[model samples]
Target: MKKNQSKISIKDIAQELGLSITTISFIINKKAKNRISDEVIQKVEAYIEKVGYKPNSAAQSLRTGKTKTIVFMVEDISDPFFSSVAKEMEKLAFDSGYKIIFCSTDNKKSRAIELISMFKDRQVDAYIITPPEDFQDEIEQLVSENQIVMLFDRFYRDADYNYVVLNNYGSTKRAVEYLKNQGFKNIAYVGLKTELSTLTDRFDGYKEAVREANRENLSLLISFDDVKSEVGNKQFEEFLELHPEIDAILFATNNLAITGLKILKKKNIQIPEDIGVITFDDRDLFELHAPAITVMSQPITSLAKEVISGTLKLLKRKHSIQDKIQIVLDGELIVRKSS
Candidate 1:
């Protein structure tokens, strides 16, 4: 019979090196510290290297009770902000010997719950979530089970968990203030109507800015379900027609900004001439536009590093982290002609 050229197992290495399977496992897992002699360790290590033996991750996971996998759940994997951060995080996690599984929740509670359950079944070592609305209960359950979880972008107020997020309120407030200072009155805020803290914080910032400036607050909060549809575009068009005096608009997200820009283009409203625009998240599309869009750019790399480090600390049990760790990074205001 033709031999199967499957991966070389720990057992094969152990037998060839005249050592016990336990010895090989201990060394491979880096658990033999001071327990095994250097001579035997060196001998086994050399032989394993010579034979090109790679440990079976499935078996190792079963023995160690760690899958070395991280589940990254975001509102939308295709969103530039999430995708950029995920890419950086994936590289960092891979360097630390962990794999990341990316999933999009589409801001749907049911989809988030389903993804969480699926990852749990596969025994992921940790979860990094940009949670949807009303996900506190599910997250609290994960935390109760000692499952490592790191919330990103948005978080539930009632849930205590590790998170790395931007200063949403401050960033939006600053962007609005910049517009107000530039003589843009009748500024309108465009955002999704969602209970997620991230959007709410941004909305609060816009309201606060308008109030502080002694200007009337104008906003269009589209339904989360309809934000991407023709209904949303029509809503924007109606909003503009309802308030022809709106000189500037701040969109709470990149996608919202994109939609608003498209509406403006259709209406032949020139940017910064008839309407000034500023968006919460930065994107290449914004930069490539005729008049580049000013944006509140999140520190994606910093966020990714903090998240990866926090997750690794939890997985390695390196230190006793607080019950809940909250790391809020600042967003940079990238000035452009649009604003």
Candidate 2:
């Protein structure tokens, strides 16, 4: 029988250098701080280079009780808005010594719950959740367990958690009022259900905008569970057959707005001339279009940095922040040809 090659262990390194395992482990892990001689450190470093070594993250996490990992749970990764946010977050988190894992729930409550449980079981250092529902008890349990949790882009009035979000109500209201200022009378609202507080807030703003403009006859179209691209196309086709007099549209999210753009192209309707458009979340598609899109642009860079910074602070157990405080960053309305 051929002899098998045994993997090198910290014990082998310690024995070879005539040092204790604890000293070897500490030196390998870069925890050497107890006035160890430079000569011994050099010897260990030289030996480590001679032998190819790989550190196991799981083992290190078990020893230190910190994985230095963050979970970013979003409603849908397919949406360009959320994808951009995730990219920005990954960049910032990586720069700050944290690895980020993304989860796309597709706006399903069950998937959201499953991802949260998996991350918790894996002992993720922190979570930045744009959850599918207002999960108060689960989040509170996380907090009680000394896990850092931060909510982003959505708010639950009853849950006491750290959060960073846009000024949804104010921004949506402003977008509508701007359309009204441009003389759009029959503005319609297109969106999904109210599982997320941002949706509810945007709806509230839409109603407020209509009321403030004294447009009582304005139509409110709610796209129940399905408001995705295909669903929006079918809904819009049916919507036009019934309510063809709508002069403008205010999309609660950018995906709805993009879908609306496609529908308009199909109907051969000119934007801002025949129908005006405004939506939340701006991206290159909206920016570079012929009739450039008007949008409520969230401060993504600032938001990403703030969320990560807040999460890290919580992880370090530095200080207890003000409870139920909503950091509502103002959104800018970038105006172009499409209202």
Candidate 3:
């Protein structure tokens, strides 16, 4: 504890901990989730405390709320649905005098919990989360402490929190109903297997519509872990092989639909002739596909506006609100050559 010690910059801490300056920077700035090991974060943070090193940003945040930063945590940043929403909200948030930083939770409870805990060590003014599995207790804790949180994509059915999501049940139901009207028999559902409400509601919707239409409720639920692996491809292939009667498919997510298309193409299956296809999310590539894939397009612009405006409203009235903000938007069914 010398009075005139030279300023201990990030370099000193980096070398002392045997880690890179970038890693140190990420940890110091509370941006190390999923990229840096938790053990490394602990070691680096402990050393910084031991050396009495304080980042200027940290000090300033203590004075005025960390420059009004918001953490928009979603399942995966690469997903077109989530990415589009983030892009739509970025400028709106900044223009409102707040900064938005994105982090992928990978739909893992452990990852989400870690990100939630990081807010404990720093000042993250608000959170727009597409949460993973069970984290009700963590979310409730945030609300108890007067933190700004907005849940998107899916929500906790048992927990009351502000959220904006699509009409998962109705959207899938209508899509499947349309296919049935078009003489699509044995319609199969393709989607990632998760407890997420978004996918679950879609399945329920499809299931109900198929039940009423007197059609078999056929579905292939791929594991979240296998979304990118060949295992998923094999599963889908096997499902298709086992169910040759399937004449139409309603994919739950964009990536799942992409996988379906690739497999179908390799098998020389013709769209709208061999099988009709409809995906949940809209993307540029979907329309650019050979047959111009059909889709249930979400309200991307409206979603962005709702989430950002809702966040700003929540931020303005941090803790005095009694009622929760809940919004559910409808999806548009865009028919194309594929269906």
Candidate 4:
């Protein structure tokens, strides 16, 4: 250690390594691989490491306009599915020298709009959002401004936005078809009523499959907030009572299935005997139930990886719709005894 160089700067490092300030800056910021020789790059890196020189990130970001931060907005951070995906993304982002700021949108338009404004104020490098309804304009504006935006979990079908999402329609259709193949009839889809494309697609899949089999497309839908309320529980019970012929049920989400399971358990309804059950999204409770539940298991890690990669890719491009990336992944239908 040089006693006099206690407060070393980029200028000091540049002078000591006999490299120009621009050269040192390029190397430090990982932007010199093509222009700088490997030997020189290694030497500069070694010197920087030995001197423990850390660039002033605030100043660097001012010059480069990069925060190396990604804001990930989900429907609900407390939900198992969103949290699990976030855990995977956090590590991947850190490894790539970026950090994630997680925010829960709760499927609210105003909240999402507020978050987007915050992202601008904070100079967030990129946005990976699971958006709610009625905010397509905000997204479009961001895209027009040459900002990095990656939509995940759900996206607008009509909009040419960068996104990675599950094949909700296909997966749900397959699950219902599987149940029908196993001799379960009069299957009813229990789903949340929503305009969100993903949820709508899931219901559409269930409807199409049921109709194809020369059966009535029976379904029960409730508000998203009603899933946990007393009103929601009553709707499930009454819906079952109204249609005793419904021998099998496809719950659109884990939360809905959990509520339905409780009602069934209270009534001593034996699964697969009185009624078969299947749901989207696997949970630990589903795996450990009295009769383990059947599920359409989403690729959480794959979703995370794709979003991170897509966000980074978007950052490099013009950040317009023309260069947008789209990914559609499949969910595994894990059959268990409950179905």
Candidate 5:
């Protein structure tokens, strides 16, 4: 009743109402539909509301074997794409009576594995991951144990896991084609050096477009570990200097684009004049830039909805779902002055 008082418990409610704890629990767990009378249910409900008694989640998890918690593993939580998607997913999951724990893999396989094991130890109900390369064995093990798993943003081609992804290849291809149409002759791609399918597809898309146009493929791949470092900036500047013929650049990820943009600015390279630019993932900073960056925007809202819905379906069905689900959503190419 006090401002800083401890939370009221089911036992307290039972004691107050002169009812057994079992009866209170059955009602609280919504298992009294036909077995319990309406009068007793109404009394219990009224008393619960009056006292604001809350059931212990840990105890409930033990009794029901459902923790109602999900782990969302991503490469970088601070990235706008992942963070935006996370916010939406968290809201949806919370509304559906589940909580989400976001963990950044930092594009490290070892870190991802450790987080996966930790979440497993916590008995999380489900997992939504943007997995790193060579981590299929751990995911496969989770699947084998009948754990609900949903891959998002990226996934392994060989693994049969439920996933929600963007059309990486097609989007990047279109972006390149658009740049070509804008009369940019030599377009180069700056991408992360990781083996993520998302980055690979984008790179492949760039290659396809360049090959089709009879233009030489000019691309630079930076290691993920060095992506945010000054060394990456130097590498990108060197790549640009080495390929003077490259009049345009397509960055594979938002971070790469941000880095490239800074380097370009430092060198006084005018966008759309000296080097046209288009990024894969959209960010607010991109839109607010001088020339306003063009980008292949992933459907963050749709991705969140589908991922959460898919995760919920798996959690509800538990081991009943045999076939893996894969949903690939389209990305929109937002044309801006930079391109």
Candidate 6:
């Protein structure tokens, strides 16, 4: 209670409680390997409060060689699909005694690389990435160094790593099949243009549906790599103008689907009545819109669990486990007025 007291330290708390600073450190950080008595721990903690002692996370991390943190790098954090996945992953990581930080690249390759370098220097415990462009080389290097890097929602062409993704091919095929059954003669597909395995798989499903329909009479319009609102909306508008008779559009992701809605609204196009809409992932805005939008929602919780468990398994391995699991969870189609 002095007028100008200096900053408190572990030494001060230890001196006041008649214990060594090492004991106080172990008890406070819950690293009491020898099972320090409850009474001693309580006394140290109480004295810590009395002296206003605080532990420095940097120092603790240096001593333990563990940040106890995981990082998730995604194309766009604002995108409904990534946002949902981030929330679930954070919750699961926290429950398992780890923290998670989300890094959004906006689908930029350079940005993703910068974050990868930064996280590496910071010694993050693990990473889950939806990489940009040809970052598989970078990811492979990390994996070779025994870093825990799990691919989520996407897969690399020549790299072997853990991944949790939805069954993109089957889901999109089902969506297109549904539209065809509803008498939609002109079906279009909209999504980002990337070598990303997920988008490619979904695009394959769209192609399969077209080929299986055996309808040379039906029209198919495919749009790709529409990331931003302005770009996406403009492209969608141009497509609609060029093909005025398109009956249904299948979006590869929720962000593209949202942009499609904006363009359709501006053009005064009626849903299902004029142009049917079905998006890949669901969000709150989709449910609250004028006519609730339908979605093919991924199993976010299951995906998170799978990735986290896989990372833990990797961390426990003597060498990289050759059990490369490409888990393909299902996406549910939520039908609404738009479809």
Clashes of 4: 0
- In model 4, pairs of residues that clash are none
> What do the candidate models score in CA lDDT, each in turn?
0.89, 0.80, 0.88, 0.90, 0.89, 0.80
State each model's C-alpha RMSD to the native.
Answer: 2.3, 3.7, 11.9, 2.4, 1.8, 3.4
Instruction: Report the lDDT tens digits of candidate 2 across residue range 1-339.
Output: 312224777887889889999888888787886757778888898877777655567888999888989998888777777788888888888887799998798767788888888887899988888867657666778778777778998878776678998888898889988988999888888876666788888888888988888885454455545555576588777886677788888888876777778888999989889899988898898989879988888888888878887787777763455554347788999898997
Total backbone clashes of candidate 2, pairs 3 or more residues apart or in separate chains: 0
Candidate number that wins on lDDT, 5 or 6? 5
Per-residue CA lDDT of candidate 1, range 95-132, in tens?
99999999999888999999888888999999999889
lDDT of 3: 0.88
Local accuracy of candidate 3 as per-residue lDDT tens digits, 1-339: 532224878887888777898899889887899999899999997787777777776555774565578899999988888899999999899998788889998888899888878865667889999888776777888888888899998898888899999999999999999998888888999987878899999999988999999999899999988876799999999999999999999999888898889999999999989999999989999999999999999999999999999989998887795789999999999999999
Greater TM-score among 2 and 4 belongs to 4
Question: What is residue 247's positional error in candidate 5, in angstroms?
Answer: 1.2
Q: Which of the predicted structures, 3 or 4, would earn the higher TM-score when compared with the native?
A: 4
In model 6, which runs have C-alpha deviations exceeding 4 angstroms?
1-6, 34-52, 216-235, 241-245, 312-322
What is the clash tally of candidate 1?
Answer: 0
Best by lDDT: 4
Candidate 1 ranges with C-alpha deviation above 4 Å = 1-7, 318-323
| Superior by TM-score: candidate 2 or candidate 3 | 2
Which 10 residues in a row give candidate 5 its minimum summed lDDT? 1-10
Which scores better on TM-score, 2 or 5? 5
**Which regions of candidate 5 are displaced past 4 Å?**
1-12
Please list the residue runs of candidate 3 whose C-alpha ends up more than 4 Å from where it truly belongs after superposition. Answer: 1-60
Q: State residue 238's C-alpha deviation in candidate 4, in Å.
A: 0.9
lDDT of 5 by residue, 26-83 (tens): 9999998988899999999987776666678898999999898999999889988899
lDDT of 4: 0.90
lDDT of 4 by residue, 1-339 (tens): 733334888898888888899998889888997999999999998887777777887988998989899999989999999999999999988998899999998889999998899889999999898888877888898878877888888899798888999999999999999989999889999998898888999999999998999888889999998999999999999998999898999999999999999999988899989999999999999999989999999999999899888887777774344556899999999999988
